[model samples]
Target: MATPGGVEVIGTDPAEAQTVKLLSNLLWFGQVVAVTEAMLLGRATGIEPTRLQELLAARSGSSRLLERDYGTVLRGDYMGAFGIDRVVEQLATVREMAAELSVPFELSSLVARVHEDALATYGPVAGEMLAAKLLEERSGGALALERLHEE
Candidate 1:
């Protein structure tokens, strides 16, 4: 049987697949935070955020998540495809799972806390990427870019 735009896994049980899904969400949250911090540092250090986005896009640092968020972040659009509250929830689950399994979750715990702070700061409905504002507020600099929406 053929799956449409999906992968077929052999011999992996439901519990393992659930783990994979949770880990994927955790990774995505980590990606948003990591790329936001990197680009925020660039802007704080006297670089244009858009240019930083361009350089990163061209360089080995580029990834799909980075490319996807660069424009939204630079433009300060908190339009939620996903919300900070939801990411925090997922991270919380991942954190609990880590504790139950005796896994080192220091980084995950930190990221989850960061998102919790972000949710508190930005409101529960704010976009997941709204956490970028946390960096801007901390740095006292703007991450604004001229938004270019292709019609």
Candidate 2:
């Protein structure tokens, strides 16, 4: 990741480096929307979300995001590592970047909408995974551990 100048330089171009960071955040936001939706879908279909989450984690669908965060989700604790409002903002930037490049951005747009909904529902300060809470609420069940329900 070192630039041509020296090992201390992260990138040769500042704009390109910023774009890389933005795209990485955008991908993470997309993954959150997707993983949460899958959990909700499994719950709606009579499968325990925890079990389904385990299956996804163990199989080809596994992602670093899912592996690291899904357990926190099951515990009813959406990590406050990032805010829903920040997620929405990042997605919007990605959408604008895509439009400028004349690239098809349907998936990015959808992901943005999901984060927007979460932001609207939970406000700016809520954690990134509040989107999962929104989906769970819409499904009339939660993706929480049984002990979380007891508490």
Please list the Cα RMSD from the true structure of every candidate, rounded to 1 decimal place.
4.2, 3.6
The sequence of per-residue lDDT tens digits that candidate 2 reaches over residues 1-151 is 3557764444678777678778988888888889988888887788887789878989988998878777888888877878888888888888999999999999889888888998888889859787777777777667897743764
Give the whole-model CA lDDT for all candidates, comma-separated.
0.76, 0.81
lDDT of 1 at 118: 90
After superposition, the stretches of candidate 1 with alpha carbons farther than 4 Å from their true spots are 1-4, 146-151
Model 1 reaches what TM-score against the true structure?
A: 0.82
lDDT of 1 by residue, 1-151 (tens): 1259687563457677667778987887877778878887776787877888888888887877767756777776755888788888888999989999999999878778778889998788858776677766676665775432321
Clashes of each: 0, 0
Top of the candidates by TM-score: 2
Error of 2 at 11 (Å): 3.7
Our model 2 lands, by Cα RMSD against the true structure, at: 3.6
